[model samples]
Target: MLHIVNKSPQERPSLDACLRIAESGSILLIEDAVYAAVKGSASAGKLAEAAKKHRIYVLLPDVEARAIADRLVDGVTGIDYGGFVDLVADHRACQSWL
Candidate 1:
């Protein structure tokens, strides 16, 4: 499965909610949710935990737009739109954690 989180972890619990329910699948952070990929951000700890069981990914455009592309968390993979499409195609389904 593919889990997409687009909300800021600072403003909403959607990321946490998604992480809790996500299994050994993939978590894609886009829009404001990309902030969670920053190594020392408030939500980084939760992301780290999520990484233990799931493959974590961050939208490259989002991360670069936020200017944190170079500081992404150790295990988070940064992907482009093409990569996003590939992920969606690779997974059987997707869940959007708005």
Candidate 2:
């Protein structure tokens, strides 16, 4: 299943939602959600680690806005805008956390 989130790691249980539902082949992170990818974000790292440990396919974008786009850690695949839209379309269900 695909879960496209666009919130920072600390707001309104976005991380909690991810932890509760993310499984193998789950897609995560979008827009502001990418903040979690930055270093020093515990929930983000934990989520990524858990996804990897479970072989879940976690994805994020590489666009830079408020900060440089290099904050996303290893293991999370970065896709282009078209791919992102395709992912959202292919996923079917969506829970907007932004």
Candidate 3:
């Protein structure tokens, strides 16, 4: 399964909710949710913990747009739109945590 979170952790509980229920799957952070992908942000620890259980990814364009391209957590993979499309195709299902 793939979980897509598009909201900021600081602005909503979407990311938290997604992380709480997420198991051994994949998580793709897009839009404002990319803020949580930062290396030392508030959700950094939680994201790092989640990475141990699930594959974590962030939209490369979003990270660049937000100007945090260089601060991504160590294990979070940055992907482009084509990669996002590939992920959707690779997974059996996708749940968007808006």
Candidate 4:
């Protein structure tokens, strides 16, 4: 399963809710949710912990657009649009947290 979150953790509980419920799978942070992938953000620790059980990814373009590409959390992989497509194709199912 793939869990996709596009909201900022600072502004929404969608990321927290998804993390709590998703046991094991992949997580792709897109749009403002890329903020959660930053090195020292409030959700950084939680995201790091989640990375143990989930394959954590942030959309590279989104991170770059936000100008925080250099500060991404250590374990979170950065992906491009093509990588995003491949993730959706690789997973059997996907849930986008609103």
Best by TM-score: 4
Predicted candidate 3, C-alpha RMSD: 0.7
Pairwise TM-score winner, candidates 1 and 4: 4
Better of 2 and 3 by lDDT: 3
What is the C-alpha lDDT profile of model 4 across 1-98, one tens digit per residue?
99999999999999999999997999999999999998888999999999999999999989989999989989988899999999999999999999
Worst 10 residues of 2 by lDDT: 54-63
| lDDT of model 1 at position 46 | 84
Ranking by TM-score: 4, 3, 1, 2
Candidate 3 worst ten-residue window by lDDT: 15-24
Q: For candidate 1, write residues 1-98 as lDDT tens digits.
A: 99999999989999989977778899999999999888888988888888889999999999889899888889998899999999999999999998
Task: Residues 1-98, candidate 3: write the lDDT tens digits.
Answer: 99999999999999999988877899999999999988778999999999999999999999999999988889999899999999999999999998
For residues 1-98, could you state the per-residue lDDT of candidate 2 as single tens digits?
A: 66677776766577567666766556567766666667667666676676664322334333466463666566666677777677778775756544
TM per prediction: 0.96, 0.71, 0.97, 0.98
Q: Count the backbone clashes (under 3 Å) in each candidate.
A: 0, 0, 0, 0
Model 2 sits at a Cα RMSD from the real structure of: 3.0
Steric clash pairs (candidate 4): none
